[model samples]
Target: MKNILQEVFETLRDFLSVNSPEQSHMLTVYANLDQANPLNRKERPAWLIELKNTFDNLSEEQKNALMTFDGASLTWNGIEEQIISTLEQHEAKGRSVVVFTDLSDTVVIDLPLPVKTGVYYGIPQVKHMLSQLHRYGQYLVVLFSEREHRTVFVDVPTLVSEGTLQSSLGEGIFLRPGGNKTRTQASERRNLDTERRMLREAAGEINDYFMDEPLFDRIVFGGNLKIAHGVKNNLHHAVAEQLVSIEPIPFDATDEQLRETVSILADEYEAVHDLALIQELILRGETCGRAASGMDEVMDALQNGQVRKLYLPYPMDADDFDTLLIEAVLENVEVELVHGIAAETLREMGGVGAALYYVIR
Candidate 1:
């Protein structure tokens, strides 16, 4: 039996395409193949063989028509030459050429004469990369005479501020934007300051209703960028050192981008929720250890269903851990395994940590 790694190398070397200019850009042949090997040689035989065979069995027509090149080593000069030559030869022969490559390192391509050039890659390197491709009436391709092909850029500002507001009803609270509104005169300053205070107060009132013990899993502030920022800040202050996260709801963010962001936040929340529950459990154990007279108090709390969530440290003595876990299950308490708390702490402590809860009530 041939070694799977060697088989894959041979397969790629054989079936790989490098016939067209576009396909040349796709090839990203690596010299240090060991780095790309994701699995142990012994355990990965089946996978290696399957992968090797999949590429090895390509149709002859596909193989012959395909073009391949190495992104890892192909120089900029080589890229230009290959693309230009391929275009000239194919165009003169009365055939259009298209390229394909799995690995993308080729930056751009310029066609000769009347031929058109288009780059298809994961994403472009333009600064302030848009979350989604914009849909407009017609695609514009404005050319500049600058020989250097200067990159275009856009400005994006990050929001960072802190302050608090309270509602007249007492339970509601809000946080307004921090820092001066602008470097203008007294009238403008007064107006901005007053607006900030008002926004904070409104946010405070909304948050007040949420501060009751055993509040809901999360309180999300979405809509109106400025107002959302204020709400996030106020909630952070009100929650203090607990946990919270501020997610900016972009006016232009698409459904897909929003969905991806939500998914990421959910994963983060689960992690934080687990860590906080575990930290509390550790604290309970420490408190029990330090107590002069009564471990019975801690036991009583556990027995009476006072523990809302339980955090079990990783790599515990299996037998003891199972026993405790079973007992907690019987009591209907939630359990989690703590990994790292830093990121979760940041999230939940603000809205980041806010996604998870410890209530401590």
Candidate 2:
């Protein structure tokens, strides 16, 4: 609603001209009232509560001229009296005042009117007020009765859209429209979730899967809410601890939102779980005349200093592997030593040899 009001104001300001039906400040006021009551609802006739601070600039005669049934007078004050009276009436109604003139020597009061919208009568006044407001470096406010029920306060120089601010105030969940590949993607997530659930429910399969694995890094379950939760619970029960983090990807999530969620999940998994997986190839254990073994086969890669990173047990003495560590450092390898509760739990799930970050390219 506030946004619609701002759009109207912007349109009015951008295209106001002599040919335009809305002219003269007084006419603008009437137009604003009509605009506020666009539907011409007889019951809700819009009222313009004009607050006038008539100083000596307006003689008693001119001041009287302003009182000709323009609208309901919210409050009127003598120049001698402080503007606080008008401010009070405005605050009572939760509305902001649109100061007509951009008086150069404007004063700032801590009156409760937090949001301000200021309007100069026309371009000359607008330019002058803008300059004067700039000199004072104070927030200027003016009110626009956009619709009968809505009033928007916009700062002159800043030209901030009140509606935009309101919209941005809350965390908005924008559901993206489904894409051509959405069904396929959703189906895959469902299948992966089902697989994890089945493995966990069948404890024998779960144990068999992990029995001979050297280490496992991270287990990611992606699916809808129900399947995701099922996989998560099953993995927890199977491993006697949480083995996977359940990331429920919404079917209608934007690419950017999905990317952000995936990044966050990856970071959490890396911090808490080891990205290593151990798989015992019972059916094809001896392949290419080599028996499956951990660390020993990869030892040459570790020695040649080709290892980019070493995920070692937290409690393992660095001194015992200092030579390999130095070689790794020389080869610019990152050695992450997994420790504490994460070490104990993730090791059972498959410890330090985990994928930290994945790059699509």
Candidate 3:
């Protein structure tokens, strides 16, 4: 099941990155047309009916371009069934209909956004799950210990264990108590130094782990607070800055334990992240004046390709900004769907904001 979801995620990602130039009507119908509970699958959904009506009402040109002239080759009935069945397989909460002229490559993505659909001339606005994907695969967790250092990569839609690194600080009976008290004390001091060195070495190992790989957006140290801090101090400043939280776990944590820890931390990190970005948007809008806000300003920024990150309040009546949202996405802008306090923040900023790639002055 996890593998299936992963595969879906990969497919969605590929579609999101695609910037196809082939023109003509590429029908996009995003609708929530299924019951959440299987038992409630009573009758055809209103959205499906509405979707069919939508197609039926399309201008002759749009209809012909979408399903072909006279509509014999690909009927709406068959396409609707295909969309529903595909979405159901992925436990999709919402429907995304991307039926291109190239029917063989047509697909329905099971992204769980509230149904708000639109169609544009060029590439369908590919959001690429900017926030969700960013949240996932961005954690680098290390469980530090004097004996060994264990690490795992916990990410979205899936949790992954990255394995471990055992310490070689003082191998075999280095702390055996014997001989004179002074000698014992001196050896004890040496052992303590060795322990610190081992931790430092662990930090270096962690740093090296990310040198060739993409740097994690968040780093979590999973061990004793003091020891985690000690190891943290040795981390490269760039990596150090990405640190999220310190959590205590066993030196050799089970995969389940690591997964649980990662899940909890990931949730907490996203919460803080949403709040921080919202506050920053509000703050910047008020003071620095960099946040391009309001429907008009945001739309203009998007069209001018100035928006680097776009913040839109979730559960919004997105009909007004849907086209602009797609334009921003196709322009490679990062789009975030913020809710709760963040949603209220957007209300003050005219319901949208953008971090500009460059001021449009």
Clashing residue pairs, candidate 3? none
> Cα deviation in Å at residue 194, candidate 2?
32
**Model 2 C-alpha lDDT versus the unseen true structure:** 0.33
My TM-score estimates for the predictions, one after another, are: 0.30, 0.21, 0.63
Worst window of 10 by summed lDDT in candidate 3: 169-178
Model 3 Cα lDDT, one tens digit per residue, 58-175? 6656654555622448775665566556544544444333332234455665543334443332334344333223333457777755444566876643657575444444331122
Best by lDDT: 3
Looking at model 1, residue 295 earns an lDDT score of 28
| Candidate 2 structure quality by residue, lDDT tens digits, 17-42 | 22222222221111112223334235
Ordered by lDDT, highest first, the candidates read 3, 1, 2
TM-score of 2: 0.21
lDDT of 1 at 139: 9
Residue-level error in angstroms, candidate 2, position 318 = 4.8
Q: What's the number of clashes in each of the models?
A: 37, 19, 0
lDDT at 292, model 3? 83
Output candidate 2 Cα RMSD: 28.0
**How close to the true structure is residue 151 of candidate 3, measured as C-alpha lDDT?**
68
Ranking by TM-score: 3, 1, 2
The superposed Cα distance between candidate 1 and the true structure at residue 55, in angstroms, equals: 47
